[model samples]
Target: MKRFLIFLYFISSALTALSSEKGIIDLADYHYNRKEYYYSITESMRYQYLYPRGELYSQSMLITGKSYYKGGDSGRALSVFSECYNRFTDSEAGERALFYSGLIRIDSESYNYAAKNFREYNYVYNNGIFLEESIINLSLVYALAENYDEAGKKIAGYREIFPEGKYIKQAEELSVLIKEAESRPEKSLLGAGLLSAVVPGSGYFYTENYMLGIFSFGTNAALIYGIYDGYKKKKQFQMIFFSVIEFSFYNYSLAGSIKSAHEYNENKDFKKELVLKFKSEF
Candidate 1:
């Protein structure tokens, strides 16, 4: 009985030492597999700090970023993914990092940037496990960036690349949506400006410049009130005062809001034009 107890005590001590040495890797992996991303990230970070050159460092970085992304910290995830891409270029973890970085970029409204990363991932891991997903995103990135021409070309390319893609239905629907967007006539800011000239504040409404219109209306009201008070006081100087204010601030705001409405339209049109240009090139 004494010998058995001694043997068990030594075994427990050995296990404790082993766990102390590999707690980061083992605990992180265990947490990650169980979908406990927050805990996984914590454990993985500890492992990374203790053993920067550990074999699991690449995975640790990858999972750390994944945890941040899942926890709604896309900016931090992007930063960590970039680090993984730079530090573990030859590892399988690096491939996943690059791929996921593109996805996060798209979500963060950096479509152009995501498109570049997606292209790089596609080239580096040609026909790899993520090939289908990468190709689908290639089309989607262009579309989200408002690059209809690029989106269309990429869609066609995707069809050729993945004739039987898992997301064929989704890709087809996206292709149709892009075509419809291309058909719509781009709105004209110059037209909006002309419309405003005919009807003061019309351009403001067209351009959704509500605050500016309110300011214009308010200024006009103040000018009228000044003129009325001057007439009541029988003061010639007050009439001139009201006239100056009416011609200056009130008129200026009205004209400016109309002009701004036109400019806003032009800027939106320019964005659409850029989208078409990107499509043709891509």
Candidate 2:
């Protein structure tokens, strides 16, 4: 009777421990669903502490990393995700971790690193759940970096691999945009700088900033008149002051024109639109 009671007690204790572990994970998941990222992280970490080798260990790590990410602690999130990926490389959680790491890199504007992560995920998990997402995002990363050729190739590959993929429409749209962006004429920074040097606001005009060009030209013209008047009156202090002001304005116009030219060449409007679309879609 004593031995039987002891055996029963051990079974009950095991069941209770298992139940506690499950309860912690469930609570963490509930918090995560509610977007209570801090509490989710707390519960997930508690699970990890109480059940280091628990069957739900991978899930707990994933939740902890995701919570950190949703809470805007991207650095910590990346670290946790990388750790989870390393620990459970063949698991679903590891695949998601790798994919999310790439997304975090994209948010940071680290396009090269994002591309690497996405590529790695694609290569490592050919049939992974995030395969389609990784492929599209990889192409987008290249597009963002202005690597049109590579971007096009990736999009084509995505189409070939997933003929009826959910992202086909997006891929096609991005492809058209890429072609248009490539065909657009890029402004010359050197040309803009030279124009401004020769004609106070001509650079701004070349960069299509007519209002700024007009303001720059008017200001310089007025300053030139001031200097001329000062010289004619033989006023040394007035000439020096006008000369300083004109010099400063001329430099400002020149720099502004160059910056405008660079921005025009970069096609910032297209990039801004693309980024917004990418964020909304993905």
Candidate with maximal TM-score: 2
Give the lDDT of residue 191 in candidate 2: 95
Q: Against the true structure, what is every candidate's RMSD?
A: 6.7, 5.7
Model 2 has a clash total of 0
Score every model by TM-score: 0.66, 0.84
In angstroms, give how far residue 249 of model 2 lies from its true place: 1.5
Clash list (residue pairs), candidate 1: 149-279, 150-279
Query: Model 2, residue 243: displacement in angstroms?
Result: 1.7
Best by lDDT: 2
In terms of lDDT, model 2 sits at 0.89
lDDT of 1 by residue, 1-282 (tens): 999999999999876754563656777768877878889888888878877788778888887888888778999989999999988777788888999898887667688888999899888888666777777777877776667788888778878877887767777877877786677554455655565455545556666677876666666777878898898898889989887877786556556865675566345554454344322110
Query: lDDT per residue, candidate 2, 1-282, as tens digits?
Result: 999999999999976754598888988989999999999999899889888899999889889988888888989989998999999999988998899899888878799999999999988999999888888888888988999999999999999999999989999999999999899888899999999999999999999989999999999999999999999999999999999999999999999999999988877688777766663221
Clashes of each: 2, 0
Count steric clashes of candidate 1: 2
